[model samples]
Target: MITRRMLLGTMVAAPAAACAHSLTEPEYPRVGAVERLDPRLDAIIAPDAPIEVLATGYSWAEGPTWVDRGGYLLFSDPPNNVVHRWQPGVGAAPFLKPSGLAGPIPAAVREAGANGLDIDRQGRLVMADSGTRAIARVDLATKQKTLLATRYQGKRFNSPNDLVISRTGAIYFSDPPYGFSAFDESPLRELLFNGVYRLAPDGSVALLDDSHHRPNGIGLSPDERTLYLALSDEKRPQVLAYSLDAYGMPTGAPRLFLDMSEGLAAGRPGLPDGLKVDSAGHVFATGPGGVHICTPEGDLLGIVATGKAVANCALGGPNGRDLFLTSHDMLARVRLSRPA
Candidate 1:
């Protein structure tokens, strides 16, 4: 077993430009910096904490999920069509190959892999399979995959980008054409609109909303009463909060939670994408510059700037105090004062 501390020791001894398929060496001892915007931010993240680079050399790292039972962190590399597993004592290694597209795919297709990942209550690995254009579950023991939802109103989904499981066993996800070679213009696209959907426990699919141009990430509140959807569209990059009814369906009009138009105007690196909510209701959403920490009431707390285009984040570790971040080609970790 190779622990992070041991990896750090090896990193110091290796050449700075060493490029390995598994863990790429970092040029700097630490890759990025963190910013403390408000005093309240101190409650969650320590003021003097450093952001540690865990691994690198991924084509496009996204969809980080912590498996507490296995004591490992799993993340997706969409372009490579694989999922990598990172354990404190085991370093980083490929856990799944052909993660999304299992059958013959067109030659023009570029991205054919999974994106967002979550552990269901049954301890199964649930994934937003972009290549297959569906939500799937994988059995850890046998590596068998079961397609849970693939279509809405008889039309196949463009691509399932991100997903979150509610307390009631309901699955909420976003479908954008990101998997297509030309996005919406791709000839393989089936759905006319990008949608956010809910999959009931009984295997029923319902379209929550299709108004957003590009819905990339989806998360549920601690109480499962509010759903937060991140719009990756540059024209209207924002996070929208929708109130849920008793049956876990959206009710009334959705409200703007946080708008990143100013950040876009200032030329930040990323758009609104993957997000997660803490036990106290603070939303750590991947947005312009880094992960935006905001209150449930929509107050901007601070930003965890990775100095790169961060795609997604997950709370993990024994106490859930470790924040695993998936940036452009790098995977990083930061210990938080507050646990999720």
Candidate 2:
């Protein structure tokens, strides 16, 4: 277990992108200094450790994924409908342009912005395609496009936001009615209540639960025994946790493991949209202020100190010890003793 003080011993605690931390203050920066959730966690992160801001740019940044092979980060610029690639040495550049939408002309552009990204076991670029209203993949090597999933029953999905790929090639994603609803835009009636779903290795799509109000971000614990889903549109939003079966399918009613509205006074409205887990069951959720570190029990253990309403984050760097964060018009980073 890592404690706050121990993390601070080796790290300097400061905001990398301090100016864009949030629209409002989160608890007015307490005078006694930030406290960690418990002493046991001090072994991992020190409370006063510095949070380094790596990059800052973009208009409403959404999904963030680590491209390990490229040794950098690839994330979304939603309103711009594009994806960017950022590396420490070269800085950020255009990674995927017009990432999704297609028009009459092959060069025609239509809102191709990407939402979330992940690499499959086979090394394919699996993406939560918001503009196309589907979960698609692009071969990281050949750059070939393959549609993984688009519809649940007979209706098309509203928009696929975030996804994770298991070792077995099984892909899981969260579909919420956020995008323009290109799939089924007829009367604007949502047939299925925004759900957390799974796409098996066989290419079959299964609805794990339609209960999630608006599943925004989705990730699995290192052990695969627990599944975490972020309800972005939740009133007084929260990150929910569920017990999963051996097959990696959820088996029970999802419950709130953590309520995100506690520390935030003025910040982003949604809970989280992108999340990543460490070797342990601990989860890092992008919240209104920054990347929130939570225990398996859902306790708010510490923060990465992005000083911004971090929209998404991923574990990367030389050994995955560096944390990359995202937000509206900002991209930041922090180093961690633990790997992403």
Cα TM-score per model: 0.91, 0.81
lDDT score of residue 295 within candidate 1 = 87
User: Lowest summed lDDT over 10 consecutive residues: which window, candidate 1?
Assistant: 3-12
Q: Tell me the lDDT of model 2 at 4.
A: 12
What RMSD, rounded to one decimal, does every model reach? 8.3, 9.8
Each prediction's whole-model lDDT (CA): 0.83, 0.67
Candidate number with greatest TM-score = 1
After TM-score superposition, the amount by which residue 267's alpha carbon in candidate 1 deviates from its true location, in angstroms, is 1.0
The 10-residue segment of model 2 with minimum total lDDT is 3-12
Give me the candidate number with maximum lDDT: 1
Off by over 4 Å in 1: 1-28
RMSD of 1: 8.3
Screening candidate 1 with a backbone cut-off below 3 angstroms (N, C-alpha, C), the clashing residue pairs are 2-89
- TM-score of predicted model 2? 0.81
Q: Write the per-residue lDDT of candidate 1 for residues 1-340, one digit (tens) a residue.
A: 3211111111111232122223433443466667888889888987577888889899889999987666678899987899898866457899889899977777646579999999988777899999988999998667789999988988888879899999888999999888887777878877889999999999999988888888988898989999999988777889999999999998987999999888867877788889999999899998888889898998887888888778899987656798888988899988899787
